[model samples]
Target: MVPDDVVTYPTHWEADVVLRDGGTAHLRPILASDAEALQAFHVGQSERSTYFRFFAPLERLPDRDLAHFTQVDHQDRVALIAVAGEEGHEKIIAVGRYDRSGPGEAEVAFNVADDHHGRGLGSVLLEHLAAAARERGIRRFNAEVLPNNAAMIGVFREAGYVVRQHLDDGILAVSFDLDPTERSLAVMADREQ
Candidate 1:
């Protein structure tokens, strides 16, 4: 059993989101049992998608990495996944996570299946992950993307956050506060419509 003071699974963060194409997906906290599905999801992504995420052409995630990704503590390290289909047929279509890197700050990352790209899933993951991080006392989120990953940068910009970026060694480092501003909320609301 989990210690009484330790943060447990946050079922409250689970959500059913509608994509830009009117498709539906379920977003929920990651689980230890999700290793296989997560690996399968990675296997299905395009080489471009894999490179954008891992910064390398990995044929597959090693068992250790799989274990690390699937096992997360609800407090400092957290992950969320967007899944499609039902029960045994479920497929992990996307993933988002935040790892606390400093006081009141966290490093965020995401991966969306190539087939689901441009459906606004990245924005949805960012929104939910930010909300979850805030609940855990994170005040800011940061990410590092390859210079050519304009789509990822676009997702961050379209969220209406006052995103700050710095390019170094062909990588773009982006960051923004987690606090929701009027414009951020407005952008979120507009997308939800």
Candidate 2:
């Protein structure tokens, strides 16, 4: 689906406080005005989460880097933020994004705050992204995760995705398929809409 000419705005904005096991947090779409929050989220991530997300240790990003990330066309890309709740407060806890690389294929990516790991928010974010991608006719989802990120690998496995490990240049990466059940869920979600 093509992005609407009208600027994309956050809809049904409410804090999705996930109280299951993990600490509660807010889940919402990233707005164009959230560049500072996004940058802060990236900067404050643990070294491991940063490496997992960027495939390397980035000391700190300049303004240009944040701009490129925040100013994408909504037609083909989406960014979601998970901020800390009443307990954690103002800290960005998790982040996820989906980018339509081509017809039937979307690239899915996510990261959670270091202290908030193992709480299952990464999987929740991924599920939301996969459903969003499916709604946009994306059936094949791909991710580039490092070899040591067991939590992320677990997320993919829980989603019933198939994984094929390979090395691209020197960085370890895994490609996966988001199965039909995920698609069905996306469809059902659309019906509810």
Best by TM-score: 1
Task: Kindly give the stretch of ten consecutive residues in candidate 2 with the minimal lDDT sum.
Answer: 1-10
Q: Per-model C-alpha lDDT, please?
A: 0.91, 0.69
Clashes of each: 0, 0
Model 2 lDDT tens row, 89-182: 5666788887887888877788787878878678668766766666667777777777777888787776556566677876556666666566
Residue 184 CA displacement from its true place in model 2, Å: 9.7
**TM-score for all models, in order of appearance:** 0.95, 0.78
Model 1 root-mean-square deviation: 2.7
**Clash number for model 1?**
0
Cα lDDT for residue 76, model 1? 92
Model 1 lDDT tens row, 86-170:
8779999999998899999999999999989999899999999999999999999999999899899999999988999999788
